[model samples]
Target: MIDSTISSFPLIGLVLLLGLAIGSFLNVVIHRIPRGESVVRPGSRCPACGHRVRPGDNIPVIGYLRLRGRCRDCGAAISRRYPLVEMLTGIIFVAIAIKSGLTIDAALEAIFASAMIALIFTDAREQLLPDVITCPLLLFTLLAAAWRGGWGEPVAYPFDLSLVFATESETGFPAMRAAIVGGLLIAAAVPSFWLIDRLDIFLFNKYHDWQTETDSTRQLTAEEETAIASYEHQDRRMKRLAMAIAIVSSLLWVTLALRLGNHDPLAWKGAWSGLTGAVTGALVGALPLWWLRTGYYLVRGVEGLGLGDVKLMAGIGAFLGWQGALCILLISSIAGSLVGLWMMRTSTARLATAIPFGCFLGSAALAMLLKQIIWLAA
Candidate 1:
C-alpha cells in the first residue's frame, strides 16, 4: 500500500504541472479571444513593449517569481492574474487527481474546470464570453457525454419524452429510439443556427448600421480592422462546422437505424443515452434563460442577458446534464444576488449595475463539478 501510494505521487505531480501549463495558455485565451486576436499566430509577448516573451521567462509561476512579476525586456509590471491562474489551475488539477484518480473522467473534469476558469476571468475582465470558447465547448461536451454513455444516470428528459419516444427493445435497450432522438436533436442544430443568425441580425444589425453610419467618415484603427476580420471569419467557420455536424450526425443515425433495425440494439445503447442526455441538457440549460431574456426585453425595454450567457449555459448543460445545469443556474442566481447586495452596501453600486453574471455561473459550475468529484470520492 505504501509503495502504491508513493508511486501515485509522480502521476499527481505531472497532472499538476500540465494543468499549470494549460492555465498559462488559458491566460492567453482569456486576453486575446475577446479582442479577436489569434491565440496561435503571435507568441506570448509583453503587452507593454510587444517584446516576445523569452522561453526562460515563461515557466508558469516560477518564471513570474524569477522575474519579480516584471517583463524582462521592458520592466513593466505583469498582472498578478497570470501566476494566480497558474497556481489555481495546478491546485485544482491536483485535487481532481486525488479525488478522481487519473481517469478519463478526471481528464474531462480538468478540461471543464479549466474552461470555467477562463470564462470566469474573461467575463470578469471584458464582460464578454467569446463564442470561440463556448461553441467548441458545447460541441465537446456533447461528444464527451456520448463517450461517457450518459451523465452517469438516467436523464429526466423534459416533457417526459423519454417515456413516450424512448421505447425499450426486447433486450431492454432503447438503442433505436435513443438514436432517433439524438439524431433529430443534432439535425435541429442546423435550423437553430439559422434562427440565431436571424435573431442577431434583427436585434443587433440596426445598432451596427448606426455605428457604421456615424463612423463613416472616421478611419478604423488597424486593430479594429483585424478584430472585425477575425470575428467574421470565426462566425463563418462556426456556422459551417455546425452544419457539418448536424448533417453528419443525422446521416450516422440513419445508417445505424437501417443496419441494426432491432437485432443488435444493445451495442450502442450507452452512446444513444449519452447523446440524449446531452441534447436534453442543452435545451434545459438554455431555454429558461432564453425565455427570461426575451420576456425581460419586452417588459423592461432592455436586454437582461447577453446571448453569450445563453450559449455558455448550453455548453454547461451539455457537460453536466439538465439536473446539473439547473443546479448551476439556481446557485449562480443566489450567488449573484448576494454579491450584488454586498456591492451595494460597500460602494455606490445600485440594483441596476451590470454585474458579470457569467463569472458567477462559471464559478457555480466549478463548485458543482468539485462537489461531484468529492461526492464520488467519499
Candidate 2:
C-alpha cells in the first residue's frame, strides 16, 4: 500500500530538493521575465565566460558554494540573490508539505506564493511588474481560498462573515464590498487624469509635454523627430520598450480575466471574490494619487495606476475573492505608500514618478492571506 505520507524522511528530503531546484529556475525567471526575455531558450551560462552552466554546476545552493560564486571560465562573480531564492523555496516547500500533508490546495498555494515572491523580487529590482504573475495569482487564489474555507466565520458554504468581523455598523459583506467600490473608484480615476492631460496638451500646445516639456516636445516635425531620437539616445527607446511590455501584458491579462469573470463557476453564483479583491487592490493602490489629484490635477504623475498594478489587482481579484482582496488592499496601501515616500525622499526618484504599486500589493496580499489562514486554524 502506497501510504501517502510526505513527512517521511525520504519524501521530505525529496520535497526540499525539488523545491530548491525549482527555486533556482525561478531565479532565472525573476532576472529575465521583466525584460520580456526567455528563461528557457538559452540554458544557464556564466555571465563572464558565456559558458553554458554544466549540470554539476547547477545544483541550487550547493552548486553556488562549489563554484565559490564565480564562473569556471571567466572567474566572474555571481549574485547572492540566486542562493537566497533557492533556500527560500526549499524552506517554504517543506513548510507547505507539513501544512497541507500533500493536499491539492497546499500544492497550489505553495506554488502561487513562490510565483509572487519571484514577481516581487523582480519588480523591486528593475521596477518591472508584470500582469502575467498577477492574473494567474487572482484566479488560482480565489478557488484555493474558497476550497480551503479560509473565509472569516464561515456560515454558508460559499462564504459569510458579516457577523464575526462586524463593526457597530459595517458588516463583513460591506468590508468585502468596500474592496469593490474602491476598485471601481480607481479605474474611474486614472482615465480621468489621462483625459485631462490630453485636454491640456490640446488646449495649449505650449504645454507640449504637459508635465515637463523637453527638447523632443519642441521638435514637432518628422525631420526634427529623427534628429531628436538620435540626440535623445536611450531614454526614449527604453520608455518605448517599457510601454510595449506593459501594453502586451495588460491586454493578455484583461482578456483572460474577462473570460473567467464570465464563465468561472463561482462568478456565476455569488460575488466574484477574486475580481473584487483585485479591484480592491486597484483602488487602494490608486487612492493616494486620486486624492492628490483632486486638488492639484497632477497627482498620479504620467503613469496612472501603473499598468503593472492594474493587471496585478485584477489578477488578485481573480484569485483571492473580494474579502481577502480587501485585506490585501489595506495592507498594500499602508506598506506601498510608506515605501514610495521613503524611496522618493532617499533615492533619486523624482516627485510624481510612477512606481510598481502592484508589486507591493500583490506581495502584502499574499502574505496576509497566508497569515489569516494560519491564525484562524490556530
State every prediction's TM-score relative to the real structure: 0.84, 0.59
Per TM-score, the best of the predicted structures is: 1
Put down candidate 2 lDDT per residue, 1-378, tens digits, no spaces. 111456589888988998898899899888766545557869987766779998998999999999999888788899998999899788777766765566665577677768777877877676656444544444444344333433221112233332222243421233333233323432332333335446545643432331123334453777645543543343344344544544454444344434443444333222333333334433443444434433343543333444355445544543454555566777877886897788789977575545566577756755653663356457
Counting clashing residue pairs in each candidate, in order, gives: 0, 15
Q: RMSD of model 2, in Å?
A: 9.9
For each candidate in the order shown, give its overall lDDT on alpha carbons: 0.74, 0.55
RMSD of each: 4.3, 9.9
**Per-residue C-alpha lDDT of model 1 across residues 48-123, encoded as one tens digit per residue:** 9999998999999999999999999989999999999999889888877776666676678788889899999998
User: For residue 289, what is the lDDT in candidate 1?
Assistant: 81
Q: How does model 1 fare in lDDT?
A: 0.74
Error of 1 at 114 (Å): 2.3
